[model samples]
Target: MRVEDSPLIDFIREEHRFSFGTFYFFDNFIISEINEGELFDWNKASEVIRVGQEFYGEEGQINYISNRIHDYAIKPQDWLRFLYERQLFKTFAVVTYRKTAIYNLVIERFFYKGDIFSFDSLLEAVNFIREQNALEPANDFDKLTQLYNDNSL
Candidate 1:
């Protein structure tokens, strides 16, 4: 499951876990910035899923793994099925920190969740996503779902 050399990823950082450079959300996007400690189990992911519901409503079921998250700790195939079956995040973000194998697992399984991006700049990713979503005009469930499917981005 090692990510041999990512063409998709831009850079790598051993410090501060991982981070996003920027992301533009055409709809209500659930961006979770994961730290090394958070990736241990389903609890954190589940919590984020709940918040995403509040943020995006029923359609705000997408899950974006923020920064950290060593892929070795979680089984993404099972995780995706779990989320989809339970009607949690329809989409998700998969990221890597220092390990290639862990990253490989995430990328292979969670690609369909959103527009995948990689970054060594964890703060940059957080800032970018935050700023991008800041102007999203509150969480509009109706428009969000339609836009999610329609945009096909």
Candidate 2:
């Protein structure tokens, strides 16, 4: 299928969302945006990312996507599945929102502190992913964080 055959996810709030811009899967080392605050489920997001990258015709899309951005509300179950499915986890700097402790509860309730990242954007939020910029209160995270943080505004 052609890139145009895919769907666009302009918004992913409380559930996963995917937006189809001109971004061909293979266009860059990174794949696409992973919005947080939208239902936090690893399998679901991974599946979406994989299907979206199907047109790119590359298998490394998972690794590329994983390396791209902050994970909003990932859980310990999600973490386990992520690790067991891929065997070894990607070295991407995955993160979740600090202000909302819902998913963080799941993370800490099940896994160790080192297994996940907790930040308020003022802490250690990444300044960029794939070299894209970020904004505050998540100023150090990806620009998508800017979007997620500003969605309600």
Candidate 3:
């Protein structure tokens, strides 16, 4: 499904725009749409993380969904920065139909150790998140925190 037609659109808690992209914060997930040709690096990642922390708290377990509605370049290595900083997401989902983006996702998997998935439509990604969320405990912050502490240090 298109981003505008997403099932979670009505549930967005807050919407924020940045020079590089737009972030739609939901109750337990974020849908990000970066601008075309923008280079997404650690600085951009930090901005998103800060907003997520502010909206969901430092210990909140949230999923991140990248709605690649535009062509963009991302530094896959920046996942290391997030790991080093102890900022983690429950899962990462990407919605893309582009071949280049699919190749990039493969490269990203080498650096990002967490669970990541890709979908051809926004609705598919959203459904995958819902399924994953259902399998997880309602309060999995402690589990995430412990995992971070154990692996990040």
What do the candidate models score in CA lDDT, each in turn? Answer: 0.40, 0.37, 0.75
Q: Which residue pairs show backbone clashes in model 2?
A: 9-18, 9-19, 14-39, 15-39, 126-140, 135-138, 135-139, 136-139
The superposed Cα distance between candidate 1 and the true structure at residue 106, in angstroms, equals: 5.1
Could you give the candidate ranking by TM-score, starting with the highest? 3, 1, 2
TM per candidate:
0.41, 0.37, 0.81
Off by over 4 Å in 3: 5-7, 135-153
Clash count, predicted structure 1:
11
Give one digit per residue, the lDDT tens place, for model 1 in 65-105. Answer: 44443423454555565545575534344444566645565
Clashes of each: 11, 8, 0
- What digit string (tens of lDDT, one per residue) describes model 3 on residues 95-151? 987888888788888888786798887766766676676633212334433433443
Better of 1 and 3 by lDDT: 3
Q: After superposition, how far is residue 111 of candidate 1 from its true place, in Å?
A: 8.2
